[model samples]
Target: MLIELRPGTSAEAAEEVAARAGAHEDVTAWPVRLAGRVFVVVSGDESLAHVPASPAVLARRPTPDGHWLVRRDSGVAPREVTIGPPLSGPPEAPRQVGVVGGPRLWWAAGPCALESTEDAVETALTVRAQGAHALRAGLSKTRSSPYHFPGRGLRGLEALAEIRRAAAIPVITEVCDPREVAAVAEVADCLQVDGRQLDNRPLLAELGAQRRPVLLMRGPRASLDDWLRAAEFVFTRGNSAVVLCAGATGTPQQPGFGAITALRARTELPVIFDPSHSTRSASLVAPAALAASAYGADGLLIESCTKPERLYRPGDAAHMFPPESLADLVATCERVRDSARSLEVSC
Candidate 1:
C-alpha cells in the first residue's frame, strides 16, 4: 500500500507514523524521501486491518503489482487545448520511441554534432553495434561561443538520412530555427528542441505542426512549471509525441536532479536524461547515467564519438565518451535498470 502524507506535514510527524507502521509485525515501512510518502508492504492478512489512519494521511491505496501509482495535483491550470492520446510508436512496437511506459530502457547514442557523412555513418554503426536503440546528432548545432563549430546544416540532415537508411535505425537531430523544422523533419526520426529554444513559440509551433516526435530539452534556468508550460505549447498544437530531456543546471557540483524528479512526478511524458551535459565530465558520465536509471528515467541521450581526441569541438574533451567507455556505460546502466526493476517488484 502507498500512503501520501499531507502537504507541509512535519518530518517528525511523518516519522512517527512511519514508526507506528513499522512496529506492525507484518508491515515493512519504506519512506520515499523524494516524494515525502511512505510505502507499507503488508505481508500478513491481519496487519492490514490493524494499520492506523489519520487526517494527516492524504491517501492510502493498494497496489497489487507492488508498484506505486502516484498522482498529485500540480495546481497548474489546464490549457484550453485538446490533449491527444498518449504518445507512442507504431502499433507493433508501441512504446519503442515515445515516452516509454515499460521497464525496457531506450538508448540514444551518437556524436554531439554531425562531423561529416563518413563520421556520422561510422559512429552510427558503432552505436548500433553497441546496443543503442536510436541515433542522435546535431544538424544545426547551438554553441555559446561564436567561434565554435555550427554543425553541418542541410548536408548533415542528408547524411543522417543516409545513415538511417543504412543502419535501419531511427535518427534524432536538433533544430534551432523555425525555418529549418520542415527540412529537419523530412530526414530525422525525431526533432529535438534545444534547451535554449524552449521559449521560442514559433519554433515550438512549427515543430508541433510537423507531427513528428519531439525531444524538448529542459532549460537549465527554467523552473519545472516553465518547462512543462513549454511542453503544453506543443501538446496543445495537436502533437502529443513529446519527450522531456532533462539537461543539467546550476554549478557542476550541484547538478539538477530535483527538476528531473519533479518532472517525472508531474507529467506523463517520457523523461530522458542527458548525462553528458548534466555532469559535463566524461569521467562522471557512468555514475550519473547509473543514477538516472535508478531514479526512473525512461531513457538516456548520450554524446559519444568514434575519436574523442581527434574532435575539434569545444567541451569535446570534457563531454565526449569514447566507444569503449560508452559500451561499458551502457552495459552497467542496463544492469542498474534491471536491479531497479527487481527492487520495484520485490517491494
Candidate 2:
C-alpha cells in the first residue's frame, strides 16, 4: 500500500500521523510526494484502516482513468494525489561499484557459447536495435551438467567488456560464488544472484560488500516473504541499489508463478520478469510481458535472440523471439503502462 500527502499538509503533522498509522496491525508505512502532495503508502492489512474513516475522506474512489486515487475533502475542497504503480529510476549517480550506464529498458541476452569479438559486437548491435537499454549475458554459468560447455567465465567477461566498449551499453553477468563475485565485478557492470542461489546468504552478503547493483532472482520455490528478506540482507549493508528478477517456479507453472504476484505486492525494489526461463512456451511471452507490466513491474528482462533456432541454450526456442516479435512485445508493454496512467485522469 502506498500513501501520498495532499497539498498544504505539514510534514511534521503528516509524520506524526504516519507514526501512529505504522503502529496499526500489519502495516508498513512510507511517505511519497508528487506535485507537492504528500502521501503515505501503506502495505499489509492495516492500509485503508488508518485513512480517515469519516464521511469526508473515508470512502475509496477511482478517477475517470483506471488508477485508484484516494479522494478526501480537506474541509475546503476535495483533493486527489497521485501514487505511482511500481517504477524504477536510475540512482542519482552510479554507485562506486555499479554500472556506468543510466537507467533503461533492460534485455537479458543468452549467448550459450563463447564467440569472437566480432560476433559479440554484432549481437550487441541487434540488441540495441531492439531498444534494450542494457544487455545481460552469462559469463560464468551454473549449469546442471558438469561436462557441458558451461560458460566462458573470464573469457566471456572479457567479451562482455568488449561488447560494452563497442556498443556503449551497460553489461550484466552472473557470479556463482564470492570469488566469482570479485572476478565478475572486475569486468561486468552488474552482478546477478541467480534464483537457485536465493538461499545462499553468504553470496548475498558478499555481493552487498561489492556495492554494485545486484539483480536477485526469485527462486521458483521460495515464498515472497523469503525473497524480500533476502533482498534486505543486501540493503541492511547500506547497498540500496538492488533489483528483483521474477522467473517461473520449477513446477508445472514453468514460466509464471505465484511468486511473481507475491513479490510485486511486497517489495519496492525494481523487478524484471524473465519470460524465457519462466514460461517455456514462446507463445506465452507476449501475454506474460503484458501481465507483468499491468501488475506494475519495473521492467521485463526477456531473452531476444536474432535466431532462436541457431542459439546454443536449453530454454524454450519459442521464447527466444526474433527482433520484430520482441519489438511488438515492448510496444504492448508501453500500451499497458499508458492504460494504467490513463486511469488517473478519469478520476
Candidate 3:
C-alpha cells in the first residue's frame, strides 16, 4: 500500500512514519517526495494494520500496479522531458543545433557505441543535419556477453564531450556502474538506464539526484507493472525527470510495442519507442517507427550509422540504418501526425 502525506508535511513527520513502519520486522518503509507529493511506499504490510496514526496522511490506497506513486490515479501531472535548447533559439549563439520535446516530436539518433572520436563526431554531424535532437552513444555497453564490444569505456566519455563540442549537439549515453554516474553526467545531457540496469537501485538513485533527464528502457521480461515500479526507484531520490522507453519482448525479431498503451495509461512520464532496437533489423525499423509514431509516442530512439559498412555489430546491414533513412522516417512521421490532428479537427 502507499500513503501520501499532505502538502507541507514536515520531513520529520515522514521520517517518523518510516521509522514506525520499519520497526515491523516483516515490513519496510521509505518516504519519497516526487512530483510535489510526499509518499511512503510500504512493502509486506499491505493492510497498514499497525501503522501509527497521524494528521500528515492525506490518502491511503492499495498498490495494484506494483508502485502506487506512478499510477495515473496518483494525480501526478504528465511530464514531458525537454532536452537541448529550444529549436527556435539562435543556432550560432552558444550551440549550433538543439532539440526540444513536449508538444513537438523529437528524434535521437546515433550509432550504438562511440567507436572513435572521429567516427562519433562524424555520426553526430550527420544526424544533426538530418534533424536529430540528441546524439545517442554508448560509452559503456552492458551487453549480455562480455565477449562482445565493451564500448570505449570511460575513454568514450572524453569523445562524447568532444562530440558535443564538434557537432554542437546534445549527447545521450549510458552509465552501467553507479561509480560512473558523476563522470557520465559531465558529458551526457540525458542519462540512460538500459534493460540490464533496470533494477539497479543505486544507479537509479544516483541518476535521480542528478539534473539530467533519465531515459529508462523497459527490460525484455519486465511487465508494465514491473516497469512502473522500477521508475519509482529513480523518482524516490528527488528528480522525477524520467522518460520511459518501451522496448521489445526479448526476441529481437518480434519488436513487441503493444505495451505503449498500458504505459501511457499507467504513468505520467513521457513514453518513447525504440523500434530500431526492438526489431534489430534495418528493413523493419522505419515501418516499426512509423507505427509507433501513429500510436502517439512522445519521441523516437533509433540506431543509425552514417557508414553502416564500417560499423561493427553482429548484424550491421540488417540492423543499422543510415542517416538519410532516419531523416525521411522523421519527416514521414510528422506528416502523419499532422494528418491525424487534422482528421480529429474535421470530425
Candidate 4:
C-alpha cells in the first residue's frame, strides 16, 4: 500500500504516519517532490483508513506494480498525474541487450525502405561488414502523400524476413496499423511505431499486447511529457521491451539532439537516435550521428543503401548514404562510442 501525504506535510508528520501504519522503516516515506507528494510504503495488509484523518492526509492508493498515480489539487479538473518511480536517477543496464553494467552502443543501419529481398540482403551484408549490429527498414511506411510509395506491404515484409535469415542479422520494420501488428511481429525482431501513430490507441494497445520489443519514435511536435506518456501507455500494458528512437518524426523542424538529453534525464529507457531523418541530408548524417554518440545515445538508426541516388518510395533523397560511406560513418561512430565509454569509466 502507498499513502500520499498532503501538500506541505512536514518530514516529522510523514514519519509519524509511517510509524502508525507499521511501514517498514527502510522502505517508508519515499519523497517524490516532483509529483508534489510523499509516498509511504506500508504492509499490504495495512489499512490506511485506520490512521487518524487529518489535513496531512491527501490520498491513499494501492501501489500497482510498484507504481502509483496520485492526484494534484490545482485545477478545476484533475490533470493527469505523472508520478512514478524515479527512472532518471542513474544509468542502468538495459534489459533488451542483456548486458551487465557498461556502456553498450547498438548500431542499426540499412535502407530507409525495403525495396526487394536482394536489396535488403545486400545492404544488410554491407552494414554488417561495417560493424552494424541490426538491420532496419520500413516495410510499411506512414507517408504524407498516399501515392508516395506507401511501401510494398506484405511482399516487403517477406523480403525483410528473407534479409534477416540470409544476412544473419536482426530485422526491424515499422507497423502502421493495428491489424498488421501480429504479422509484423512474426517477421521482425523488433517492431517500430512511427511518430504519426503515437496517439493511435488501438495500434499502441496491439503492440503492447504482442509483447515484442518496440522502437518508439517521438512525434515531431510532441513535447517531452507527451513522449513519456506515450511510453507509459505501453509500460502499463506489460510491455517493457521498449527502445526510444528520437528524431525519427516526419516534421521538418527537427527537435534537435537536445531532446535526447531531456529524454535521458527523464527516463532510463535505452535511447537510439535517427540522424538520417533528423537532418534529412546525406552529408549531415555523419556529424549528427557523431553528435548523438557524444550526447550519450545508446545507439543510432542510420539509413544506408547500396546506391543512394536510386532510392525507393518513402526514402528521403538527401538522407540515404551509400554502403562505402556507411562504413566510414560506422567507424567514426565507433570511435566516438569508445571515447564516451572511456569518459564514463573515468567519472
Best by TM-score: 3
Q: Rate the local accuracy (lDDT) of all candidates.
A: 0.67, 0.57, 0.76, 0.66
Which order, best to worst by TM-score? Answer: 3, 1, 4, 2
Worst 10-residue lDDT window, candidate 2: 76-85
Model 1 residue 38 distance off true place after TM-score fit, in angstroms: 37
Error of 1 at 338 (Å): 3.8
Give the candidate order by descending lDDT. 3, 1, 4, 2
Candidate 3 runs further than 4 Å off:
24-28, 43-50, 85-101, 250-252, 341-347
Over 152-260, each residue of candidate 1 has an lDDT whose tens digit, in order, gives 8876766777777676667789999899898887677788888888889899878867767788887788667667767756643446567778868754434565665
User: 1-347 in candidate 3: lDDT tens per residue?
Assistant: 76778898889999887777667788888787876788776767565434668888888767675666666666663466776544222243225333334767777998877786787788888988888888898887888777778788787776777788788888789888888887887667888888868788889889877877788888888777778877877766666777888768754436656777677677778888898889878888888888887777778898987766776656644677778777788989887756665665321
Model 4 gets an lDDT of: 0.66
| Cand. 2 Cα-lDDT | 0.57
Number of the predicted model whose lDDT against the real structure is largest = 3
Model 4 segments beyond 4 Å from truth?
Answer: 1-102, 248-252, 337-347
TM-score of 2: 0.64
Superposed model 1: Cα runs more than 4 Å off:
1-99, 251-253, 341-347
True-structure RMSD for candidate 4: 11.4
- Residue 197, candidate 2: Cα error in Å is 0.4
lDDT of 2 at 81: 11
TM-score on alpha carbons, each prediction: 0.69, 0.64, 0.86, 0.69
Clashes of each: 0, 22, 1, 0
Among all windows of ten consecutive residues in candidate 4, which has the lowest summed lDDT? Answer: 76-85
